[model samples]
Target: MSDAFSPPPSPGGEVSADQRQMALFSHLSSLSGLIIPLGNILGPLILWLVKKDTMPFVEDQAKEALNFNITLGIIGIVLTIITVVTFGIGAVLTVPLGILLGIAWLVLTIMAGLKANEGQYYRYPFALRLIK
Candidate 1:
């Protein structure tokens, strides 16, 4: 045996796959509130700053969740601005846009969450991947 002690690898490497899967799920739980428009991005965004290197899968999922929430929030905010600037013309279009975006956000978030919960890596379509 080696004379000096060595710390074990991160959970993804050292723990059983089941434990790794649970870690991913716990990370997702921290993001549960993010499904609600602005709330959807807040938790994940904050968590990303703190947990990225601690776990790769969690980092990926959290980043995706944050991106998804931020995107939705931006679109909603922009649509609001457009509605105000265009004197209600933008408002007319905002409804349909909101509907489509909302549905897409919900589906994507749920899919991401469920997959993570199921112990699989969930990748979002059109998500900007910050971690390799």
Candidate 2:
């Protein structure tokens, strides 16, 4: 993990303090999954939709967060189906996979949020860019 306080150059030129904070919130919003079902997806989606047109940095970060969450959701659904089909045998795989995914989501989300807060852009590894 690099310095979370360093700001990266914005694609649309200079970034404002307000834009950086909003972008940070957009990335952090994914953690809402811990309390609300699909809240991770919803949070980023709402932030992205609300800010994309106004802030380029927020738009990029929100879209990145949204795409990563969507990919994770798909993986989770597939894992659930596999567990169901195997009649609990797949729990061996699904359980660890779920744990790993959860940890990855948490860590990556925090890193992204920190980077965004610092005005830097962070791309999630292994995330499907489904939303372009």
Candidate 3:
């Protein structure tokens, strides 16, 4: 109700590009498979495309996360098929494999987000070279 109680305007008078890029990086890291899904269609696609030239490091990291998740999904799908064809024995194998893959992906994504926060590029292992 008082001028003194008003929140301060943004320090730069406008949101900086770095701030925006970091925000996208953070969102993609958490979203991973849930929001990213296949084809890198949503969050990953936006981060990879929109942030590229403006924020190369964050964009690359987002792309890495996207590639990793898509790879994971494909691996899971393949294993599922194998499981069905093999009459469920492969299901047990694929389940644990999938869990390990998920854990590793989570770790890599978190690391990428941390590095992105510090303004560094993080490359993921087993990531396909999808975004150029």
Candidate 4:
């Protein structure tokens, strides 16, 4: 394994098939949120924690997914609060906005997964990068 502090590896650069698969799964794990609450964050968090020491590629991808999902989760909470404060009035706008947010999250996540599967590094454009 390479030194952890070294610069991130290039796409398909010296990465084995196992590493690529793990990275791919790390990104796709966010889909767990579809069935389990906060699964998006939890999935990546668990994977990252388990593999961070051994798989740098998986660590990077999982951190990206975790950060992105966390940002979206916060936005969702704010949206829900707004809708509640407005007593359903905000729903008129928040509903559509929430749907759009979900769609965007899904699309971006799938894109990231595909990139990871292809041995490419993927960074979400809007992710907050909160997890370093």
Question: lDDT (CA) for every model shown?
Answer: 0.61, 0.89, 0.61, 0.87
Stretches of candidate 1 off by over 4 Å are 1-37, 128-132
Q: In terms of lDDT, which candidate is strongest?
A: 2
RMSD of each: 9.0, 4.6, 12.3, 4.6
What's the CA RMSD of model 1 in angstroms?
A: 9.0
Worst 10 residues of 3 by lDDT: 2-11
Clashes of each: 1, 0, 0, 0
* TM-score of each model, paired residue for residue: 0.67, 0.90, 0.70, 0.89
Global Cα lDDT for candidate 2: 0.89
Over 1-132, each residue of candidate 3 has an lDDT whose tens digit, in order, gives 524222223333444457555744644545545654453335666666777676545555566666666666678789889999999988778889888877886677766666556544456657666655
Please estimate how well model 4 matches the true structure, expressed as its whole-model Cα lDDT: 0.87
Model 3: lDDT equals 0.61
Query: Which window of 10 residues has the lowest lDDT sum in candidate 4?
Result: 3-12
